[model samples]
Every structure is written in C-alpha cells, then in structure tokens.
Target: MTDTYDVVVNGASVAGCAAAVLYARRGAKVALLERRSDINAHKVLCTHYIQPCGYPVLAELGLIGELEEAGAVRNSAQYWTRWGWIRPEDRVGPGVLPHGYNVRREVLDPMLRRLAASTKGVDLLLGHTVNELLTDDGRVVGVAGTAGGERFEVRATLVVGADGKDSAIAKLAGTPSETSPNNRFSYFAHFRGLPRPEGHSAKAYYLEPDNAYVMPNDDDITVISVLPSMERLGEFKADLEGAYRRFVKALPDAPDIDAAERVTKITGTVNYPLVVRESTGPGYALVGDAALTSDPLAAVGCAWAMQSAHWLADTTAPAVLGHGDLGAALNNYRKRRAENLKAHAHLIADYATARPFNHIERFTFSAAARDSRMAEHFHVFGSRLMSVPDFLSPWAVARCSMVNGRALLRPRAQPVHSGERVLTGQGAR
Candidate 1:
C-alpha cells in the first residue's frame, strides 16, 4: 500500500485551518495546503462578521478567549426594517453560541492559521498551488501541485476542498456547482475615530433597493458597506467613492463616515453570483465556501465557513481514521450541511435580488421590531440559527398578526360627509 495521510486539505483559511486542526486533534495525520507564501497572510474583501451560529466552533477550538484578548468585539444584531429599526437587546438562547463576533480578518486569519500550524500531526504546506487531482478508478486518491516551483504529490484517504468560492479543487475534481445571479454589488471601507458606541451592536439598514451595514471591529475602527442594486454597478464604477458616499448618507441613521478618516480605500472587485456545490463524493469532499457560498447581504458567510468546516471534520474524521463507515460518514456530512443551511441560503439568495419587502414581510419586520419575543426569534433567524419555518411558526405568525392587527386599530380621523360639520355635545343634544 502506498503511504497515505488520513486527510489532505486544500486551502488554509478559516475553513481549511479549522478542519485541519480538528482532524489532527482527532489523531489523524493531515496535510494542509496553502497557495499563499505564509499561513498568517490576511484575506481582503471579507466582512469578518461571524454570526451567533459560528460561536460554538470558536469556543470548541478554545480561541474565543484569545480573540477577546486580541480585542474581538462581541456584538448583537440590529436591522432598520422598512417600518422601523429592529433592535434586539442581546443575542438570545442560553446554552451555547450566545453572542456573535466582529473581528477583522487581519486579526482572525492569522490566529486560525497559527493554531493549525502548531497542531500535532498536521503538515502546513505553504506556497503550493494545486494544479490537478490524482484519481484512480474514478475516485480521487490525492492531489498533485506545485510548491517552490517544483511539482509535489500528497496521497490521502480523503481530499478536502476548502479553497473558497472559486475553488480550483472543485473545478479539477469535476464537481458540479450552481451559480445564482446576484442582483446586488457591495462596497466597503474601514473608518477610524468614530465616536464610541455605548454597546456593541452590528447595524444593517434596509432601504428597498439599496442597503447598508455597519459593525464595530477592534482598534476602535468600524467597517461599513453598502449593497446597491446591480443596476447601479455602472454608476458606481464611474465614480466609486462618490457612489459609496451616496449610499452611506442615505441610511436612515447614517454613520459619520465624513468625519472619520477612512483607513483603507474603498475595496472590492466585481461581485460574483452566489454559488452552491455538493459536499461529498467518492473520495473527495468540500467545506466552507467551496461547497456552499451565498449572498453576504446578511453577513452569514463567515459563520457558515467556520460551521461547515467543523461539521465536515466532526463527521469525516472518524471514518478517515478507520473507526467508521466512510460512506455513511460522507452522507451524514452532506445531509447535515444541507439541512442546516438550505433554508438560510434560500433567504439570503432572495434578499440578494434587492427587491422591496412585500406587505407580509413588512408586517413581520415591524412586528418583530416591536415585541421582545418577536425580536428574539428574529435574532435567531438573522443569525442563521433558525430556519424560515422554524422562525415563522404558527405561534409566531399569530403574534405578528395580533401586533399588526392592533396597529391597524389605532384611531384615525373619519372624513366629514357632504355639508355636515363637527358639533359640540351640547349643540348636538
């Protein structure tokens, strides 16, 4: 038998590092490949908002405290719905994943990378670009790539593609993925010296076709961005800074981007449509954005990246190490990935269209904003911790109905008919 590792992971970002570290901890010999020169290299064009759903992985990896010490800001979520702003006081639910985090990629990327490099039995191979997959009998057995300008090969029982949205591994492995059109484009820049907010809360503005999001990161800096309908892409392309300013200023409660200095120039390339790929095959699997990437309008990408990696490791590690059935392990990973994310992805894709919220949506948003219970459910739903059906349960629907129905009952002036005029009680009698 040719010498083989338990697993070989391509890419060394959040998803790749998490899977590599966890699998190594489970006593598996793992190889982690990175195209970059160093594992600590930072990724640009990322919002870095890891929602509540991703908290457990941070905790499980024991990095949450270190991140907090590194000045990671824990934040709750708020949205300026069309009717009004929906502010949830804090993240709900008790046991785990109680609060989300806002940490810049500059801080997070290195931390995850270092942890993986330090883990026992994991080889962190840097500066390697996977040129092709090695297959036998129509099943992937390993990968052949280049490192230091020379070809290299790593054989493994399982291959993991965590190379992000534009996955080279998926392309080489002949995995099928669907790309959905994105009706919006995003623009973002970081600002320094903004007046300190009293509490940590990430804010999102819903302005029909145009939307804005703002969050507090470390170093007293804030990240703010706008998602304008794709129809305005050409307009933005013509004058990027001016278009960005216009959208920021249009926020119902606009931030003072004018007063604060921009730390980085407005950053982004052309927006790509959402992509979803199947998670498993005969000998290879995908994790994170490589498997499923959707609109970032709701800030769910980072969280999902952490989660999918953790889930992949949890299911596949035992089988890869000869403790379980490989087929069943792969299937479990696939189902869990789909069951947890399918509905959330649907909602994100729908919102990516940049369409105005309809009446029912408006009512629900308004109601969720007004009541604590509704706000709690909204918090869970927004964090991708709850599905649409789970969030809009019959009881929840009834509550929204009651709240909106009562809102309609507030007194309003009745139009006076023809010649009739208002009269005092005494005169009428």
Candidate 2:
C-alpha cells in the first residue's frame, strides 16, 4: 500500500515523537513510524534526568505544568568531591533551576508518545520498520517499510530520522559518524525508601576516574547509577547489585542507598561508546541520540534530545510550509546543533579520556568548594547553563585560583586541642 505525508518520521521515541508533534502542530501531515509494537517503549539504560535548560522547551510545548501535575520532582545537583560536598552557592539561590527534573524514562517516554499521537495531523504507525530510503534524483523523497507482513511506501517532501544513535537513515544517507572509545559501562536501578540527603536533591559522588550518581525521582524512588571504564566492567557485571552497594557505601557521608528497598532489578550496559554524527541530508534530518550522543555522566542526554527536536521543528517549520529549500533548511539545522553543542562534546570527550583529579581538576574542584561564588560558576557550567570556556575563562579561573592560593598558604601549626580537628584554618603553636 502507498500513503502520502508532508513529513515521514522514523523512530517514534522522544525525539521522533517531538518532531512529529511540532510538525503536525504547524499543520504539516506527519506520519510517525515506530519499530516497537508497544507505544510506551522504555529505554532501560538512561538516567532519565533533564536539565533546567530543557524546561523552556517543555513549557513551550505546554507539558511542563502537566509534568509537574503528574508528580515530577524538581532537583538540584550536589557533587560529592574528595574535598567535600559542593552544593549550589547561596548567590545562585538554588541549584534546582539549573539541574532540574528528576523523572523516570518509563513515565516520560509514554507521555511524549501519547502527546505526539494525539496531536492534530499526526498519523502514528506502530510496529513498522523502515527497510530503505525512497530517493528520487539523488534526493530522499520518502521511505519504504514493512509492517505486519505488509509492505508500505510513504512519499513525503521531508523525512526525519529520529531513530537514535544507530540511525538507519543516517547510515543510508551516508552521513559519516565518529565513535570514540567511551569504554565505560553503567549499572543502575530504581529503589524505594532511599533516604535523600537534606537540602540536596541529587548527588554525584566522583570517586576519581569512576563515579556514582544518585538521583531522587518521584514516588520516594531514587535511581543509583555507577559508571566505570571497560576495564572494570567485568568486576561490576559479575555482581551488579553488590558492586553498586559497595560504591555507594564508600562515598563520604554516604546516603542510605544500600538501605533503600530495591524497586527494580539491577541493570547494566558495558562499553557504551559516545557517538556524534552529521544529522542532515538532502531531504531529511536527525534529532536526539540520532544526531549526537555524549557520555551519560553529565546527565544531559534527555535535555539535548528534546532541545534538538525543538531546534529541528523551528528550523524546518518554515521550509515545510514552503518558505525555503528543504535541503538548505536541514543544513542550517546541522550548523545550529554543532555550534551549540560542539564545545560540550569536546569537554565530555576530554573527561572520558583524562585520568581523574589531575593537577587541573584538583585545582578547580578545590577552589570551587572553598568559595560559594566559584561553586556557583562550577554548578552552572556542569548544568549546561554556561559554555565550558565561559566557566573556565581566565577571569573565572583567576578568581578561583586566588581563593585556592589563600587556602594553601595558611600557616602550618599544632592542633587546636586534643580530640578536636580544625577543618580549614591552622591553629597556634
């Protein structure tokens, strides 16, 4: 059978669904195809935290209030460094706005799919797998797919490839991709009755080289994740639950994650390489993990995915409405994404390869922990509020360096008294 659509989107996950909804809302007839038979398909391996920058997009979609109404808990970021716990600075008011939502993917994915399916002008086709791109004169015109033993062809002016990191459309379009040796694996599971730290919404304990993140989501549940390099994958995989418990217990001022009741079985994935690729072609574009993926250590994937979807929608809406060339539109989309995220990619890449707490990281972390102002800057940088360079600029670094120098230069002296330890300043002889 043959069908027609203004835009045919492959992969009905968050990115695909968002694309379809945005295009449909702009009055374009969109056909959204999903290989999964279930509309509520869940990504088992995600941390499922969205940054504050993404709230604007959700609000624009009219879903932020709905999400809050649905019990999504707001969260701030806390880093458990060797120096101490680096909470958001007082100057920043709270870390919650920058780091944002703690929601489950199981809840989020289904809600987005339902929104896309219900949007006007969207035709959702579940359980259909695209086999090949339909091209005409070197330009992608549509797609050919198989659904339930029946072959179908969809002809559209524009095709969107939101099919994720291993996007078939990106491969078919000959878009070159760069896959780096992330070599890191993560194991995570949900737990109930985990005692969340007071005034700290989420905690990331960086135990040098490897780290564990504890994110408190709705319904008294917290997600605990540990990311270790491939060399340690076997150790973790051999006994996932035990390894997770050991890591959490080892943290300074450790939370009660070990004591928390397990609400789900422990899950793990190894050697999950980070991928970044060109996301546009003659008549198509990619979004979400389909466009680029970074180390999940930063917990920025979901936000980036949704933001990229919004960018694609905004960029292509005019072209789809006949105001510009579709190819040009897609190229513009690629340019925007690269401009916005390339620096972040470089930073993450460096972190993945660099040995932990080298001279530079130690200097930075120590400085930030001592001064709330510097901590605020660090928090903003980590939360994606400011660019990497901006956070690491000479001025910012100088301010931090000064504080660190003072902390280092304090006089060495005897203890204040027996059984009493001075945390920062030196005492008299």
- Model 2, C-alpha of 406: deviation from truth (Å): 1.9
lDDT of 2 by residue, 186-279 (tens): 8888889977665447888777788888888877788888887667767776877677788767777676765678889888777677888878
Q: RMSD in Å for candidate 2, one decimal? A: 2.4
Give the residue spans of candidate 2 off by over 4 A: 89-96, 358-360, 412-429
| Model 1 residue 148 distance off true place after TM-score fit, in angstroms | 0.5
Cα TM-score per model:
0.93, 0.93
For model 1 the local lDDT of residue 371 reads 76
lDDT of 1 at 120: 94
Clashes of 2: 0
Across 1-429, the per-residue lDDT of candidate 1 in tens digits comes to 233798999999999999999899989999999999965698887887888899999998889889999998887767887668776663443323357789999999999988988999888888989989989998899999888888889999999999999898899987888888889888899998877555667788888888778988998889998888888899999999898898788787788888998999898756668998988888989998899888777777788988998888899888999999887999999999988998888777887878888666786899987776787777778888788787888999999999878878966555544456764434443
lDDT of 2 at 161: 90
CA deviation > 4 Å runs, candidate 1: 1-3, 90-97, 412-429
Give the Å shift of residue 388 in candidate 1. 2.1
